[model samples]
Target: MTGLRPDTGRQAGTMLIVFGVVLLVSSLVVSAALAPSVGAAGNDGTPQTLVGSQGGGPGLHESGSVYLLDGKETKWKAAETDSYFDVTMLDNGSVATGFMDSGYEDCEPYESPCTHTGFRILEPTDDGGAEIVYEYSFPVRTRSNSEVHDVELLDSGEFLVSDMEYERIFTVKNGEVTWQWNASSMYDAPADPTTTDWLHINDVDALSEDRYLVSVRNANQLVVIERGEGVVEVINKDENGDGTGDPEVLLQQHNPQWLNNGSVLVADSHNDRIVELHRNNTTDEWEVAWAVYEAEGVPFSWPRDADRLANGNTLITDSLNQRVVEVNESGMTVWSYKTPYVPYEAERLPEGETVGATTYAVNEDATVYGNGDVPVLSLLLILFQTGIQVPFWFTELHVGVTLVSLTMTIAGTVLIVRDR
Candidate 1:
């Protein structure tokens, strides 16, 4: 062009170098901004790749699998059962689980009646099969698809079970209902009775000898009901006493446990957080004493359970994330285990407790991906970093350099295409 300018080649080379440098710097910034958000463990913040094997930190005895730390560990896991909901290791070295076989499709054939819900207490044998020593089943009060999401064996040889469709908690002893608290009258009847589960009570925990903590998920409240007096104190409820009013704190919560320090630890499920609420002695109101939502780059999604361990760490079941993490008081992850399937709850077994010799298979079909897969926040951070760099490059770089760099990029692309 014009007898081929002598400096054209040198100018083009400089522009290309500037363009490449800009891209490299932008990439570095983006990567640095996103790196810390990945999941890690321990106080040192060391990144860990979670494996679904036995042998690590404390064992997570969960619904579908058992993860342990000893090399010579024994594990006993059963195949998926019908209506599986809750599982726990009993003090007597047995396992108890709740089952409810009712849903919308389950009642399609039987219009007026449906399948019942039940729980079983089993003793794990040395060979890995469990012996059903005790079992109980119950029918729904209304002809709907009632389910038992939680069950606990009382010290008095009774059972405490949460019935979702019925919106009630039943206390059964000797396979007979000793006492029950009905929550149907608390809220107005839903417009669609056939499909609506009004309260959706998901968890029940014994606070003391006479007090019980109930997690009413749909109602967005935790109630401390005296064994005989019904609801004694309602946490996270509107002070105006309106059943349809907005929740003060909780939102579609799950497990609620009483801490020794007169605080209640609860999994605020829909809010994607775990919170501990303590009653203020002076104001006579529930106050958020402590909470953990997103900590040290790991975020919780629909967490269903949070158990405070003896070591002052909190073992949390990040349900939607398909993983469980143990975090210290400062919300730093000390240990973590990723599950191939969604885990509803996780508990740390005592030092000598073992699940026996079995490897429970994860339901590959039921696995739900959440924060652990392609973290949304991290992607957004990358985009934000790139956005900030664009303005910086335009304003900070010389105007001639900026235009020349962009032109050279476009010319390089055109040259490559023409050569091809």
Candidate 2:
């Protein structure tokens, strides 16, 4: 109502949907124009309290700092690679990722096929230099080639990497592919497994040594695959307490996770809800422990990716709108922030708050705030979080970004008021 007339509420509602589209178009134009002055909140001229500042140390001077992936921020020394696609930490405190061939913004140009490359970075080298444990390339057309997007390190020193274009999952041991899971095999071996087009293989996590919780975008399927010899069974959710496929489907997922209690968590991106998928009292069904979305609560425009930390906070990438939110188990957003490059995805800082994290090689560990200091599964909180950021004279940029974000705040208000 702040920007509308109730006299024509229905008419106004129709216009608002159209307004969303126009606003989206204008977003790129206006936001890009203000990019440089608003890229990352660095220094802020007045030393704003950034949660993730470096704790300080040699070769590990990147404590509380979060980098913008532009190869600039001092936090990550990009000796090579254009932009970082995905990143995960190893048990030895090292890191690895599917390094994109070029800087990722929106998406790669149609003509330039940015090949997905695989590489690893080892820290605390002898001369204060970071060493490369291994850098390998995937086959362009093979089932597990081209882009090795997400990697999950198994307890046995091997890792499972999702192959985006290939519609497959490969297991890597010391930088070599030793095993693979193709969609065709999982789906009764159709010649063209691309039917599912599960376009974005965003996340993969270990349910156990042999099973995984994989996020397949197109099929909207969150599959739990059993890797015992050759086993493929669909774990159905039972909505009724009777332990059978009693009722509703808990999720249509974009990202799914297994909780500490063995209950499954599914990020239903299309429906914009994070539904808890778990077994019911009966043997054949599952129930939705909880759901967070427009219908349930958060009313997210596009909730892309999410992860659960040991500390009970869930890091979610609110992609299209460009924000990352840390929500409590009760669905209350606790610490929230957004960044550019879609910040599309984020990995937990290597260590817990007690672990030393660096920002551009600078060391300063005065305070510890757990995942509060770290960031990003992807698109940071506000769309403006990405762009050319400067320290002073931020009056205009702040106002503009604020106005745009009012849309988000208002939607929530509308929902609340309407509910009552």
RMSD of each: 13.0, 14.2
lDDT of 1 by residue, 263-309 (tens): 67778776667777776667766666667775446556567777776
How does model 2 fare in lDDT?
0.47
Best model per TM-score: 1
Q: What is the lDDT of residue 327 in candidate 2?
A: 64
Clashing residue pairs found in predicted model 1: 55-68, 56-69, 74-356, 75-356, 75-358, 76-355
TM-score for candidate 2, please give it. 0.55
Can you tell me which runs of candidate 1 are displaced by over 4 Å? 1-74, 101-115, 129-131, 139-145, 189-195, 240-248, 351-420
Per-residue CA lDDT of model 2 for 1-420, tens digit only, reads 364455454454445545655665566566556643222322223211111111122211112122322222224433344334445555675565554443322233333343435444535355433555676554233222244556666788787777666677778886678887776555434455434344455567676788776665544455667675543444453334333222134233444556633356555565555556555445544555556652112245445556666565666655444445656655666555445324435544533211111111012212211221111213323222223321112234444554565674466446445534
